[model samples]
Target: MTDYVSTTPGLYPLPDWAKDDLSDLKGHQKHDLISGDESEEITAAYEEAREEVIGVQQDADLDRIVEGQLRWDDMLAHPLAVHDAVETRGIVRYYDNNNFYREPVVQDDLGFSGDVANELEAAAELLEADDDLQAVLPGPYSLADLATDEQYGDEAEFLGAIADFLEGEVDAFPEHETLFLLEPSLVESAPEDGLDERASEAIDQVAGATDADVVVQPYWGALEEKVYAHLLDADIDAVGFDFVAEQDDNLYNIQEYGATDDVSLGLADGQNTLVEDPEAIRDRVEWVYDQLPVAEFETVYLTTNTETFYLPSGKFEAKLEILAEAAALAEVKAA
Candidate 1:
C-alpha cells in the first residue's frame, strides 16, 4: 500500500471571510491585478489561508495534508489559463455543475513554469510531517476535453501535448506522498469511440512523470465500461469513485473489474452543505467491504465525490471532520 489518506480533491472553497481578500490572489500571478503595492498583502493572505486549510486537516487528524489550492481558479484550466501560451476564452460549464470556468484556448506549444510545484513547496513549509504532503492537478484527458485546441489540431496530438505539458509540471512537483489527477470529464463527457486507449495512454504519460503514487479520480458520475477498464490500465497507483452521485454504476464497475490495491471511496457528497453523520459514513465503508471482494486493497481512502470547494467553508470544514471520524470508526489505518 502506498499510504492511508483522508484528503479532499484539493480545490477547497475560500472561507466566506477570506473571499474578498484572497479572491485577487490568483489575479496577482496571472497579472490580472498586478499592483506591485499588494505584493506583501497577497503573500500574507495566502499564508493565512494556507494555515487555515492545513490547520483543519490537523484538527481532523487527517494523515495527508494539502495546501488547499486556495489560489487556484479551477483544477483543469487554471494552469493552462494562466500560461502565456494559452488564452482565457469565454466561461463554460464545469462538467454538469452549476459552476463555470474560463475555457483555455491553446495557441502555442505547451510549457511549464513550476506553478503547482511552487504551491506544493509553500504547503510543505507549513507541515511538520513532511511525508504526509500530497498534491493535486487536473488530469490530461480532461484538460484536453475542457479546453479549445487550436495549437494541436488533431485530437490525439492535442491530448499528447496536454499530457506532455502536465508531465513537465509533474517533474517539478515537490516531494509528496500522493498526487491526485482530477479527471471528471472521463465521467461527464465520455471519450469518443475507440478513443479510450488514447485517453488512457495520455494519462499514463503524465503519471509517469511523478514519483508520488498517482490517483486518477474521476467524478460527477462514473466512467463508461471501456473508459473504466482503460483507466485501470493506466499507470495509476489508485482510483476514486463518486459513490454519492453514481453509486450503483461505480459499485458495479468495481465488482466487475476489481480494483487497484489502493482505492479512494468518495462517500461524502461534495456538492451539498449538509454534513453526514460519521456513523453513516462508516456504515457505507463497511457495506462496501461486505458487498465487494476488495479486501486485498492495501488502503481505502475516504474522500468526497468531487472537490469540496462547492460547499461553504464552514460546511467544507465540517465535512473534513466527518471524514476523519468515520475513518477512525472504520479503523482505516490512514485517516
Candidate 2:
C-alpha cells in the first residue's frame, strides 16, 4: 500500500504581500508596454509575491506548496496554450468582470496556436524547486464553462478535447510525489439539464489521462448527488468537497464517500477574511476520522475552496498566519 500522506487544505488564504503585489498591476493596461513588451515592475512584483506566499506556506509546515498563483495573470494570458489544443472557439466569456483581469473573450472557435509543453515544463520546474509542492491546474470543466461558446456550438465537444489536452499535459510532468490538483470552479454552475452528464464525461476523460493522483476539486456550492456520484465512480485518486461553503451537507456526503476513495476536507475558507479556528477545524476532521480507518483518514486534506476571495496582500499574510496556527494545533491534536 502507498504510505500515508497528508497535505494542507488547498489555498491557505491569500496574504497581504500577495494583495499588494496584485494592486501594483491592477490598473496597468494589458498588452501595454510598461517595460519593453512586458512590465518589469509587474514581473518583479509577482515574483516577490509568489515567493512570499510560498514562504508563508513553508513556515506553516504545509506538506505541499502552491506557487502563490502569482503567475495567474501570466497563465490567463496564455489560455491559448490549453485552449487551442481543443478545436473550437469564439470569444471566451468571463464568468464575471470582477474575477478575471482580462476583458477580451475569444471571438472564434478555440484552437491551440502554440505548444504548451514549455509552459508545463516551467511550472513543473517551479513546483519541483520546493520539496513539498504540488501543481494545480484549472480543470477542463471550468475551461469549457469559461470559454466563449459562440463558435463551438456545443460545449461538450470543446470540453472533451480539452480533457485530452490536459491528459497530455499531466503526462509531461516530471516524476515526483507531486500531486496535480484539477480545480473546476465552474462545476457549481453546471445546468440542471443534461449539462451534468456532459460535465461528468469531461471529468472522466481528464481523470483517465493522468498518472499522478488526481483531485477533482469544486468549490463555491454544494455538489449535487447526481454530479458527485459520477466522480465516485470515476478513476480519480480523490474528490475534494468544499465544506466551508456547504458544511453540514458536504460533511455528511464526505462521510458517505470517504468510505471508498480518498476525500479532501476543504475546511479553510479560500475566499474570505474570516480566520478559521483551528480547534473547530480539528474537531470536524476528528468527526470524519471516526468513520474511517486511520490510513483512509490520511487521504484527507485541509484547504480552501478557491483563492479568488482575498482582500489584499497584508490581510492575505495575516490569514496565512492564522491558518498555520490552526493547522499546527490540529497536528498536535492528531499526533
lDDT of each: 0.82, 0.55
Give the top-scoring candidate (lDDT).
1
Residue-level lDDT of model 1, residues 1-335, one tens digit each, is 33335777888987776777665555533323322234677768867888889988888887778889876665567778777788786767877667777778899998875777877888888888543888888999888988998888899899999989999998998888888899998988899877889999999999899888889899988889889998889888899988898888888899999888889989999989989999898888777777787765787788988888888888999999998888777775323
lDDT of 2 by residue, 201-265 (tens): 77676666556667777777667766666657667777776767787666566555543356666
Q: In model 2, which regions exceed 4 Å deviation? A: 1-27, 30-41, 74-98, 101-130, 175-187, 191-194, 255-260, 289-296, 321-335
* Worst 10-residue lDDT window, candidate 2: 29-38
Clashes of each: 0, 30
Measured against the true structure, the TM-scores of the candidates, in listed sequence, are 0.92, 0.75
